[model samples]
Target chain A: MGAPEPLPARFAPGARVQVRRADPPGHVRTPWYCRGHAGVIERICGSFANPEELAYNRDGLPAQPLYRVRFSCRELWQDYAGNAGDAVEIEIFQHWLEPA
Target chain B: MRSHHDMGGRPAGKCEPSEHEYELWEKRVDALMMLLSDKERQLLKVDELRRNIESLGADAYDRMGYYERWMHSICQTLIQRGVISIDELGRKMAELEARDGRA
Candidate 1:
């Protein structure tokens, strides 16, 4: 069989997106706290890792690009300090994000 | 030292009408106590779990991605057991978000 299809690269820096939580027994980069939450793409970190590669014993899963997403502290927390302008940056796999 | 007329203000009915009624009340109290104890135990367990998870450090945390997957499985299990409705699951998810300051 031909090599496995490369995972799709979806977003770029400055793009708005939402993270999705993929449930069940599989590797995923998205965290539960940020799942379904809207955030802005901060930086597109180059691809070198894929959770599926490690979770399942399949190194064939092509390397997928990762991204650094920034979400406002208030967006993620109820009691976040309003004046600090805090944000959370997480390295999420491309598949976790979609256009927002 | 009181006359029978002085008992007028007291409840005149039987303390327990039937053995069945007594048993039902006993069961109700037992259920309530069990629920309270369970709530306390779960709270402590959750706190400990959170601490253990957080103590893993940043690199180790990234390496271990099963916690969320496990939590999702827990939610599904609760739903299947009828302990929580779908709406309650959503609410619990929202609570998690709020805890992380995402909500």
Candidate 2:
């Protein structure tokens, strides 16, 4: 059988992106609250850990750098104050994001 | 007359337990209790979330984007709370696949 295909790495710092929330039974770091929500990448944290690898007993899998994403509270939460520019920073595993 | 069977319970076995032994026993029991309680709490949370999802009904579920957003939050919470380590969560997913007989 052919070797397993390497997982795709997408998105980079300063890129706008949205998280896709597939159902359970898959490894993903993007929180549900932020899925389908738009945000700008604040930093391209190095890839060192893959949540899928760690979740599947593959601790030895190459470390994938986690990105620190910044999402505006208003974008994520309805009824968020229009005047307040609140934001939340979350570390998302590489697979969680895709270009908006 | 001597009774054929001792009416009084035999004196409690007098094996003096050491302080270390007492501590070890206490720790073991506490760990077991915590593990059990943690599992129960995790199951309850999962159940609650599932019910909430179900109650939303199919159309609403998609409209609200329930699976994509809410599920991820629950998984993150589980990781944050230490109820399940990242590895354990992976194992669970693997098990589900195996059950479905998916290669």
Candidate 3:
């Protein structure tokens, strides 16, 4: 089968976004911690086949745009006692992000 | 449902990281993973490996070492792809065990 048409990159760098909180079965690269958290787009990391579909041995065509999202440590953990300025970055697929 | 493999940010004891040289079998498993996932072969995708590893219940995940999990996933992937059958694998393993017993 041929590669699926690529999805367009919607959010630009520095755009405010939130990770989707929905949980579905099968393989998901989006970690549970980041779900429902708000973050800013750090940078664009190009597009790749969706790992969710790839796990099933399917041709994960229509590659999705990937972005490095930056979230403050406090935003991730409610009881975080570390430096308030501390932040964590994660590479997230476009499908998992929505405008904040 | 939260999978056992998703252990990010969970409260846990302090991590005492250590390193050790890979054993022969571990090396073989790593090499096998690379060769199978290589572009030309493409018999296995890293996603498949992760899926299988995640499917392994929490108990097995905790008990098995890193490469042991990878080895299990590799065999499962090959079987899922019909590249080899369970009966064939069982027979081969039994044959090797018999030979070792004789030795």
Candidate 4:
């Protein structure tokens, strides 16, 4: 961790956001399940070195904000077997999200 | 490419959470990998390691056990980063096998 470089959060807590469904070839952290799904931003997980770049040994300079996005299980999986009330959460890099 | 590692929703089978004994080597493998991932070490990042594992061919990924997958990924990363060489590793393995009397 380095000195906190204040970066503006793109989405606010409780804001609706959608995960980009772009399946660009290469290493990515956004799981396939969450792709194209709309969810609520649970919280801003603060700025950190971008993992996508970090994987390539590149300094994740100008860290990006990560968000804990929450989605209903029923919404995420059409054939979801768990309770409809159940939800799936994933931490997504800000770059992958867009206002819904 | 969508690797087998991301098959979360695919219909595989029932969610039978089977409990099993952890082999000593498996435990050690986990610890060793984590140690290598320490900030001071920076030998590999978790995501980088994951991408390495995911990039494996489907046959290899499906055939490997959990810790076996970790072992393979760690070894591949070390080799790719030039931190170690396959020749050196193979030589060490041969020496160990010889010491163990495994012709």
lDDT tens digits, residue span B18-97, model 4: 99899999999999888988988988788778878888889999998989988898888889888999999999999999
Model 2, span B20-100: residue lDDT tens: 434554565444434433745433233333333344434555465423434544455456556679998899899998988
Where does model 1 exceed 4 Å of error?
A1-8, B1-103
lDDT of 1 by residue, B1-103 (tens): 2222123224456677544334554555444434522745332122222333444445655564444423433444345446679997689889988998953
Q: Which ten residues in a row have the lowest lDDT in candidate 1 chain B?
A: B1-10
lDDT of 2 by residue, A35-87 (tens): 67788888877656455444443442456556788888887777777656788
- Candidate 4 has an lDDT of 0.87
Candidate 4 is graded, for docking, as medium
Across all candidates, what is each one's fraction of true contacts kept?
0.00, 0.00, 0.84, 0.56
- lDDT (tens digit, per residue) of candidate 1 on A1-100: 8656666668878999988754533334356667778899999887754654533223525777789999887887767767667888988888778898
Instruction: State each candidate's clash count.
Output: 5, 11, 1, 0
Q: Give the Å shift of residue B35 in candidate 2.
A: 18
* Top of the candidates by lDDT: 3
Across all models, the iRMS values in order are 24.0, 24.0, 0.5, 1.5
Chain A TM-score across all models, in listed order: 0.79, 0.75, 0.94, 0.88
- Which candidate, 1 or 2, would have the higher TM-score against the true structure? 1
Candidate 2 lDDT:
0.57
DockQ value for model 3:
0.90
DockQ, per-model, please? 0.01, 0.01, 0.90, 0.64
